[model samples]
Target: MTTAALGPNRTSRLAARRGRQRRWHRNRQPIGLLYVAPFAVLFAMFLVWPTIYGFYLSFTDRNLAGASAPSFVGLANYLEAFADQVVWRSMGNTVWFTVLTTIPLVILPLVVALLVNLNLRGQWFWRLAIFMPFLLASTVVSQIFTWLFNPDLGLINAALGSIGMTGPAWLQDPKTAMTAVVIATVWWTIGFNFLLFLAALQNIPAQIYEAASVDGASAWRQVFLITLPLIRRTVLLVVALQVLASIKVFDQIYQMTGGGPANSTRAILMYVYDTGFSNYRLGYASAISYIFFVIVVVLSLVQVRFFSRKADR
Candidate 1:
């Protein structure tokens, strides 16, 4: 065949191959979707539907005990939420809790992971000891700490007595209420972050450390230059996860303090619970929840953008 005729024939073959691949891909897509269909159904039924219904409820005056059907009140619930001092206070407490817990959750785990990763005696014991608390259910952990924080007979107070010092009421005193919660939270959840940091540490190549050692870099210097830089992504991930967890803190505080000490430790989620279930103000509670949800979503987006920029660099 002439070169021009051969070119047209080759083009037709290439087009045919591309068309077949496209058809195959199109055919496979439905199978892929079918495989995911169960999960999608459950997700839509539970998550998507509830979220949409909750958002709709936020704009109404739906009381569980009310005789009338829910009537739309436009922005009344949101406006009330904005003016609600308790809501604002609870939000402040949530922010305080997040700030108090984030540092320990991010940094302490890294330190513990570093220690456990060392060639020490009984490393397995140390790993188990650190992470065991994380495996405990929130109720179990809270009950344990409740006893420990007891003003008179608790171990913490007893230890203080041995030192000839008095331990203040932890769960009851307004001053110490959130502090006690923060302490329990840090102790309980640090293990999960520790395991994550340990995993990240293990993935670091030993040869990198050897190269640093050959260059006469001190251990601390090597950690600052090599270890931290390599595990920066993991550190960020732990921080983000910790922040979200801290913000959504309910079970521990609810079980331990019940938002007591004049509601000093009342977190946002606790406020939502009180509004919806306790007070029967479902509509207002939903509004408050949606507002908090928006805040969380915004924070997640910001974190994602920050990491994306860092990754790009």
Candidate 2:
């Protein structure tokens, strides 16, 4: 055929293919919507509506016990939050806890994962032993640690006493209270990060290590050059997750210390709870929570951007 005649036939075929795609998409649109409808409805009802309602409540004086309706207070709640020294103190405590826990949470689990990945005897037992703590409920973990850290009667103090050393009250004193909580949190949650790292490590191709071995690379060298570089993405994910989890720490502190020793361990979430439920200042609590929500969102965005740039490079 001549070039001009062939061009028209190709154009018609392309137009027909486009028409079929459009018709197929139209036919499947209802089914696709049906698949997503349940999740969409739940998200709107539970997440979206509550978020909007909470934001609205932040601008009002919604006393829990008051018989009257919530009164519009504009920025009064926010202004009060800024001036509240307790709020600032609680925020500082939360930041300190995050700093204290982030290092161990990110690093120790990696070590455990590496150890478990070794071709050792009874590897399954080691994996199960390390990960069992993570399967326990937060309350159960707290209770276990509570007994272990009891000032005079605790096993920790008893162990110290045998060596002529006195152990400081772990959960009672302000200096050691947060440290104790951090220890318990690390023990309880490191399993999760361990599992994440183990999965990532296992996904690494065995042939890469074999190639390194053929090149006379030692085990340690292979880990540094081949394994670590490949799992950089997983490491970043674990760090980000640990940071966010540390920031929102509440259950352990609440169950263990109750923000005691003059509110030294009062995390931001605990402060919010006290304000909303204990003090019956729902509006003020909402303002504080919204402020925290913004901080978390900003931190998450920063982490995402940092990882994206690292990945691109």
lDDT of each: 0.93, 0.93
Candidate 2, residues 209-304: lDDT per residue as tens digits? 888899999989988988899999999999888888899999999999999888999999999999999989899999999999998899888888
Please identify model 1 stretches exceeding 4 Å from their true place. 1-23
| Candidate No. with top lDDT | 1
Error of 1 at 240 (Å): 0.8
Question: After best superposition, candidate 2 residue 12: deviation in angstroms?
Answer: 20
Considering summed lDDT, which 10 consecutive residues are worst modelled in model 2?
26-35
TM-score of each: 0.91, 0.91
TM-score for predicted model 2 compared with the true structure: 0.91
Residue-level lDDT of model 1, residues 115-220, one tens digit each, is 8877689988998899999999999999999999999989999999999999999999999999999999999999899999999999999999999999999999
Candidate 2, lDDT over the whole model: 0.93
